[model samples]
Target: MKSISRATIGLTSSVSVLGVVLLAVLVYCCIHFWQAKQQEETANRALHAVEHLLLKPTSEYSPEDVKHGLEEVLGGQGRTQARVVDSRGNRMFGPEVFFNGEGSIREFSQVFETELPQLQAKRVELAVSTVDDERFLNFISGIFASSIVLWILVSVLISMRLIRLVLRPINRLTERIHNLGPRSLDVVLDDHKAPLELRPFIDGFNRLLGQLRENREQLKLFNSNVAHELNTPLSSLTISHELLQRRKLIEGEDLQKIVGDHLDELDRMARIIRSMLFLANANQGRKLQLQPVPSLRQLVVSVAEYLEQLAEDRDLRITVKSDATVEAETELIKRAVSNLLSNAIRYAQANTEITVHITLEAERVWIKVSNEGPTIDPLKLNRLFEPFFRAEEGRSDTGSNHGLGLAIVAAIAKLHGGDVFASSENQVTVIGFSIQTKRQSASG
Candidate 1:
């Protein structure tokens, strides 16, 4: 790829070319105007000299004398020619007016009736050469050409220098980035100290670095959590298997119970692996199979009914309110709603009401599940949707809640072109998500 310096220099050169062309045109116009004015003044001077010669009585000066006076007035510069002629087109005096050089000429003529009645009307014609003016114009043009060439050279050198100065910050940034390793992700670029033009780039880079740092930390935490979660059940299964192998004899019912426990542990592991895979795919932006659900309220009600037993266990009553129609992936939306309802049921106060409210707006359908429970810490509330992130109160006694519920909900919401939100205040926690309605989804 071409360097920015070269690109900038090329652009400067193009502009200089245009400026030089314009300047040359202006100079040419000025020189042409000066030449025209000079020619006019020369004509006026010759005319004045001819008038003076005519002031003498016609008898006092012969044609030859008038010619001589005209010659003296016009000078012997070989640039001007003058001749006196009769009205009959016959030359009266003065040398033959002719030119052999290649140059422009201006002609002036004056017809006068002399006092000699016998003499026909005489005409004075003057031809002025522009070869001297052409030579001067050539000299000026040469100087301008040389100056333009020099200016272009100087401009290129200056442009290169300025480009270097302009790109110095970028070069420093590049070096800083080059020296960075994964362990050094905490380092941040100082945008405040950077030039205004580079601040946006610096700020963006700093934000990216921050995100990388955050992701790295989350990855470490996630790995640790995964190991802990899997290790508990694996250890139990291993112990059960080892005990069975060591037993010399075992009763049939006892064997059956042990096998059942093993199956349960295996199921839990399967569920964890499945949830992790689902999240991985979701993060990769896997496409959803979408369809129109005529009644969002009904969907929530179905999810609530499915989990009614769990709510009953907590002595909580699940109630769904409002109605909305939305375009969504049915299974994923159901999963998201189920997760919200399950989470609410887990934390809801005994004998309290858990409400699922569905609101239909112009473009979106919001599903909110609010339950009376201990207030979630405001600082950790936002992070509840991140995988493996859970408040102290959220550590389930049954070991079935793996803290991936809300994360899955968030992923589903994103798939449906929405997001998840949670807020807890006054012993009431509301967790919900929104999905685009049919019209909105179609237009989008």
Candidate 2:
């Protein structure tokens, strides 16, 4: 990438060039105006000299007198010549020189009528050459050109310094980012000291760092939980294998039962692994292939039916209410509902009803499962959907429930562009999720 300093310098140079062009035009105009003013003043002086000569007595109005009078008024400069002419256009006074100057010549004439007929209709003419004015203007232009060159050089130097000053903070930020390691994830840029223009960027980057730090901590906790969960079943299987190896004296039926228990443990391990994989995919933002669910009520009903035996064990009745049509991954939705129903059945009070309520509002479908169970602590309620985070009451059932069920439900909800929520109050616990319906997705 090109340096920002270079780009800024180029821009400043362009502005400088534009300013110089405008300044040059202004100088040229001023020089031209000065030249015109000087010529006008000189012509006025010659006119005044001619008027004085006319005021003299006609007897004293000899050509020599007229010439001397004009010369005295006009300074007899070689560049400026004056002559007096009669009505017949014959030169009668002043120099007889015709201009042969190096520059353009300008002539001024004033015809006067005198009271003496002898001097009647005399024309006074002054010719001025622009050679001296041109030389002076040239000299002034040279100085201005030199000044403009110096100004450009100084401006370039100042611009470079300013660019460096402006970019110092950004360079420092880049270096700081470059030096960051996993251990330094908590470090943040100080926006307070940053330039106003860069504060927003610094603040946003600091926020991203904050998120990364949070995710890193979560990943560490997740890894530890996964190891602890898998270790239980592995330990059980290991102990069973070791017992079988040492006790060949055990009967066939006992041996088969032991093998079956091992299989169950293996199955539990498989479920945990599968749940972890699903959570990983979800966190990675894997896209879901969505299909239209004809009725949300039917879906909940089907999940309830599948877990009917589990509900029956607790003497809990499963009741589903309302319906909504939504766009979602059908199997994932079913899995999420199954997890919610199973969780409700596990915790619900015996002989109490577990209600599955579906609500449709503003193009969103909410499916809430409420069970008559012990109220969950508000503090723990928010974390109920986190992986491996089972409530105290459910921890004893870790052999069958590794606590990934609710987390899976949360992931599925997120896959459908929704979220999971939980609340426990008034001896009734409710766990639910909301999904965007087909109409909502289409509109969005």
Candidate 3:
């Protein structure tokens, strides 16, 4: 047999169920109708045989002989009820027949009356009735039960087989697609055996992936070109700043002031470039590529030691504590710590304390920088880590700040799978960061 698909199975199963149900009802009706017809025909034959036999009988034989012949003719197949009576209505023979309705003895004798008018005859009759109807009732119940069980079994088998067949092509297609990697971006998802309805959806997904690949290539090229172009101008600016510092256009105090101003500007530019590089490296998943370096304690100490003068210059005191190991790119980690220190030193009240802590917690390292400063707007805090985002843009020219410092700090932290947080209340503002530790085997 050809295998039926799910749709056809459903149709076939439904049709079979309907046919069986109808057939059962038809068979029951047919049996009742056929048996009734057969009983009537048998009764007619017996009446004819009895009239012919009885007419010869009473003259040549005894009444007992006629009765015995009639009884023998109508024996069991199904129960048969009968009666025989004389023209005056006296009972002649047969087992007792329950008198039902207004049935008359003359009407019953009419069986042979049509064939033998005015002839002496014995009236004969037969009727089919439900003596015990429970057999038919049991038959109907069994048919219903069997039908229900068969319907469930067949439906389950059909649905299961259909579900498996439908999913087979899809499962195969999924495996083929998953086994393909970035190396097979050019390859198409197999449409062979793919359902007609699903092909369009699959095609759309593949087209989307193709577009994403093209966009990524364009972005990579653009990033490279922009970095190169910007570096050229930065180099020229560096050389000009150096040559100007060497010139004697203005002497002593004036020369020192000009160089300081130019140095700050140069520092700002350098920071922007460094921030870009850190962000680029961070997102590219370069965490494992960073060299393992001194513990968090040493990194903090180094930054504090360098920024100690700037702290003192601003009448601020600095303190460092703790010893904890961490894995990170040294230069970037130092830059991040220094930015936090510089930000603290810049914003702290003129003669207050700046506290720096290096903490070792289970599985990681943390750096905390705290200072007494005015509270920052919480709304501004969220965007504080975005590139070139300056909250103090409203500040006077003399008090202006290059806002890329905190952004670069965040970038460097992320490059090492770390993060920075800021919190402030009253006169205290805290800046903190955490980093994961890398342990070395004692033998290494």
Best by lDDT: 2
Residues 48-144 of candidate 2: C-alpha lDDT, one tens digit per residue:
7777777677676775565566567655467677777878988776666646444677888997866665554378888888878888888878887
* Reference-based lDDT, residue 296, model 3: 61
Clashes of each: 0, 0, 0
User: How would you encode candidate 1's per-residue C-alpha lDDT over 1-444 as one tens digit per residue?
Assistant: 997789999999879877996889798889889898988888777766776785568768886675567667655357666766787989765566546445788888887776655445478787888878888888888888888888888888988899899889889888999999998898988877679988888888889998899899899999998998899889999999899889978888998899889898889889889999999999999998888787777788888889989988889998877777677899999999989988888778999999988876667778899999999899999899988888765456536788889999999888888877799999999999988755532111
Q: Cα lDDT for residue 127, model 1?
A: 81
lDDT of 3 by residue, 73-135 (tens): 544234445656656666555545533532322122334432233333446655444433336
TM-score attained by model 2: 0.81
- What CA root-mean-square deviation does each model show from the true structure? 3.4, 4.5, 16.0
* Model 1 score (lDDT): 0.82
Order candidates by lDDT, high to low.
Answer: 2, 1, 3
> Which ranges of candidate 1 are over 4 A from the true structure?
51-78, 99-104, 111-115, 393-395, 438-444
Error of 1 at 320 (Å): 1.1
Best by TM-score: 1
What does the lDDT read for residue 282 in candidate 3?
Answer: 69
